[model samples]
Target chain A: MFECLFEQASLLKKICEAIKELTDQACFEVSGTGISLQAMDSSHVSLVSFLLRNEHFSQFRCDRNLTLGLNLKMITKILKTAGNEDRVTLRAEDDGDHLVMVIESKTGNKISSYEVKMLDIDQQAFGVNETDYKASTKMSSEEFQRICHDLLVVGDTVSIEMTKDGITFSVSGTETSGCITCRQSGTVDDESVGTEITLQEPMNLSFALKFLNLFTKATPLSNSVSIEMSADQPLCIHYDIGDMGNIRYFLAPKIDDEEGAGAAGAPAAAPTEAAGGDDE
Target chain B: MGIKHLMQVILENAPDAVVENPVPSYFGRVIGIDASMALYQFLIAVRVEGQQLTNDKGEVTSHLMGMFTRTTKMMAAGLRPVYVFDGRPPEAKQNELARRHEVREDAKEKEAEAKEAGDQAEMERFSRRQVRVNQQHCDEAKRLLTLMGIPYIEAPGEAEAQCAALCRAGKIWATGSEDMDSLCFGSPILLRNLTFSEARKLPIREVHLDQVIAGLGLTMPQFVDFCILCGCDYCGTIKGIGEKNALKLIKRWGTIEQALEHLDKTKFPLPESFNYQQARALFQQPEVLDPARVDLRWGQPDEEGLVQFLVGEKQFAEDRVRATTARLRASKQTATQSRLEQFMGPPAIMTSCSAPPGPWPMVQGPIVLTPSPFPPLRQQAGAAAAEKGNKKARTSAKGAKGAAKATATKPAAKKR
Candidate 1:
């Protein structure tokens, strides 16, 4: 049996919104520590790993580690019906075919109970081993999202070059060419629109703008994002989803595309110590 | 490339989404209608021989006539319809619009050839294909709808998108359109063949968007991608990617990009510079007016204006207009009465049998009931009507006595 309560439905709603885009159905592993979901998109081009600490819940319990498979879209739809302030509680039994959920008003007067059928998803425990990246950047998610949105019109691929000068995102298409540069800032400021970058070595990588846009779907989960990249590995975009845990997205870079070469000059890479904002 | 047979694919794959519901079951429900689609359907269906319906002045009257009968029938059936008209179309629709234009132009040339050859069948078919809805047609349609007290709104973009937005905002119950793209637009419910004749063997169908999402087991974004793959008005489809392939690929790979990668490029080459993402964005968030600003009201029809437009200007049979208007008025009354009964429990009826002697003095013999205030007007002039009325009167008189006895015996029985 497993049960958890969220004081605010918006948190759960944000989590579901971030994952539903990547997968229709996901297996959620419920353990004593918390509930965590790890699934790769159908294409296997990207993987989304989400963790929600058990202590973050007002009430959390688990008799055994049970894997509850749920249709993320269904959860998103049900969550759409919940008011942002409604208290949400989820309960399920070991090997149960259904997951029961209750949403209540803050005052506990209005209550709605929903029972969503659970799927028989095989237990699959997987994790991405920690990687020491050649270069990483800590920047405002809003700025990153804006960069992706604006460059989307110019081309389909975005090239990121990290160096001592700062990280630069540039795109070039048949008719339009544009570049946005974010110089590393030395101080922490506003939560949104703040730019900070940490670069250990000069690294240049390219990724599909569409996938980058999809990653920004997690923008609502965090105000800041940390981008870690290695030579030819998939870029890891991490968002700290409040006190609960973090949601990380690993997106494969576009290996070879004409847009990469045609884009404005690929800035020379610069090497420097990793920014202090990176993970300890 | 509006995914050829995308609707058929949805119908086949998500059978549970489509439901055959009775027309009357939708009574009291507000339906958002695509006015342009309805007009186009009318132009195609309501033709006599190879020619279109026109007024004495040679102006097309098919739309006016079609909407008149359809709105009247819907009103009589207690279904409130609010028509939505398409405004300036998006630039992306230019290709589709041009394609349609070419089709009509080709049909026009064929129609002339058929006419010269005296091939009646070919001429009829090509002539039907050449039918088009223009500005004057739209103006007359709006004018007629206005005179009939029906509510209509001109959407800033696609009418179906506006209808879907209204459904999303809870401004309307469902959208009525022949195309299933309304599903892609995220309409909560889409009623198909709402304008088709009931005499046909096929039944009217409705698809719930929620069930569609559940049945497809795809997230809304994936569903939109699926639609784009099959084809959409906004963009071209990847060659050789039909409905079945698109569904299989989307369901298997989750997105077009992955599906494209998995597919053999030699068999299905991706279009050059295919803007599937842009098309996806268009479906994900269509431009529509704020729902709160929309005001939908059903007011009294302008009888004088209707007659002036339909009979005086459009040369409709005056008697036909009068008869339809009368029917509309009567149905409106009945609908109101039914609505009242539905809300406030059934109206209190006087039990004529009770003999408490509070309101009226006791009558020694059979008490005659005054003739009913409301009677079938035509029936009242016939002998059968009198006989029926007399029988009803006698039954009520006897009913009064019987009721009194039952009431009187209840207390005695209790005492015993």
Candidate 2:
């Protein structure tokens, strides 16, 4: 009864690719508004969620809201079958068990379909909203990916500090320490290349670089990425999927270890305490 | 058949008859088990996510598994368990047994219908409703008990009656079962919820008969008649008369005969074959082995025999069996405890402790299985008939495979 058509198969592949590192399976909430997914990793450390709004699809039809527990890997495998340009349509009956997916070639000459078995996952998906962040910054997706990737060799965690001037990415390992600071651009022709920093108060936060590196999987889908942070709160990494919707990743900030945090934050929930207990 | 709503009625009327927390009181004491009842409970419980546990021969071994692990855990916690087996049903109880058989038959049909509809919830409910402790089931338990050196007696008539008599003779401290009718047979200490794992936090509810008699303000004979008025496994009661109403009638008339004679039969029709007299006699003078001559003892468990029977034959995980034997070895300190300690050191390995709230495969029962995630596909209820039938959908199978349901004194049976 509910179905959503994505013009390109590549979007789903990228989304699944982005989330695979965070969780194996995710509950896809399909409704009249759009198809959205929110799931925490088994370790409950980081969480990833995506909302694909209705306007994004060429043809969208939904009779009722349906929650589908899908294996991300299986979806990735299914998506791999279609070419990047293929128009993929996901449909499921109201009370039916399988989520039927139909992929049609851009030329409309060839078509393929698959029925993915759904699982009865009982855990509730946590909701995230736009909170009053201490600091927010936007930069080129390539810049963000490079900064995350470049910082990896230097240290395990990158301590990020944002102020009135711009955002600073700092990493201090046992033997070496490095810092990459991006100054706010005065004016730009394109938003992708333009760097913007909005700050209520200067905030310094630390996060595991590996999780940030994983979030860069969505880099190919968008030209720009946004970073939002608050004191003792989880850092929000976002990639807006061309005005249709967005994919957001939340990583708990490193606690106790300020500059050179040894291991990955121990999957702390210090920031998630305000975000509600649902995320954990 | 367990004196429908008798436990609840007693608790409601005379709360003093019930002991709230009796767990600490059971240490180092011999508790008599209604063997058939315990087996029924075990078979219903040991399910791995709603599927029955079975051996390669297609023989269901949930009872054996439950008995072995539970008995070992009981011994580890310093409890002397005496399992009393059911021998034969008395003549007066035939009608009640037949009625139970019919109910099971009906449940079997309902289970099939539920399966056909893919209603996992209803299917699991119906499956638990169809718990049958046949002679073969009893034999399997006896084999395991023998391997573990747990002493068990074959009662002449009813296991409940024998347990009550044994308790009265001071051979056992209390009769352990979920049946409220254990009180009907005049068990001085009828302890319920012993069939489930102790880790469940279900405070063992102990019923004292003397306290009940004193609480109800009735003599022993009057109490027996009151129990019959409530209903027992021996006979049917007048329809439309529930436990509380029955209690009021018993208190008013003092006996079922007087109540039957005095009440109008139009509103509450008496059953045609209502034989309250024979039931009264059966409850008063139950056929049981003389507790004086009974040899209640805990002997050494044959380690090789247990491993051979449970692991080799029954497909139980070998390490678990060895682990349990190790615990049994560590537990002996007294004449019993020394033999226990003389055998091995401390490695308390009763998987039921870590076993998730098991067996009551209600909606979404998930327990972390140690040996394997899922056992080989379980045999169907009617295995021979349904062997070739496409495997039933277990897609919505698991959540917490633990015995969380404490079968308390609920009166759901009165509707039908």
lDDT of each structure? 0.70, 0.71
Error of 2 at A92 (Å): 73
True contacts kept of each: 0.00, 0.00
Write down the C-alpha DockQ for each prediction. Answer: 0.00, 0.02
What is the Cα-based TM-score of model 2?
0.48
RMSD of each: 32.2, 22.7
What is candidate 2's lDDT per residue for A22-96, written digit by digit as tens? 777666755444566666654344667777755446776655445667888999998999999999998887667
Best by TM-score: 1
Q: lDDT: which candidate is best?
A: 2
Q: What is candidate 1's DockQ?
A: 0.00
| TM-score, one value per model | 0.49, 0.48
TM-score of only chain B in every candidate structure: 0.79, 0.78
**Model 1 spans with C-alpha error above 4 angstroms:** A1-280, B1-3, B198-202, B336-416
Chain A TM-scores, per candidate, are 0.88, 0.87
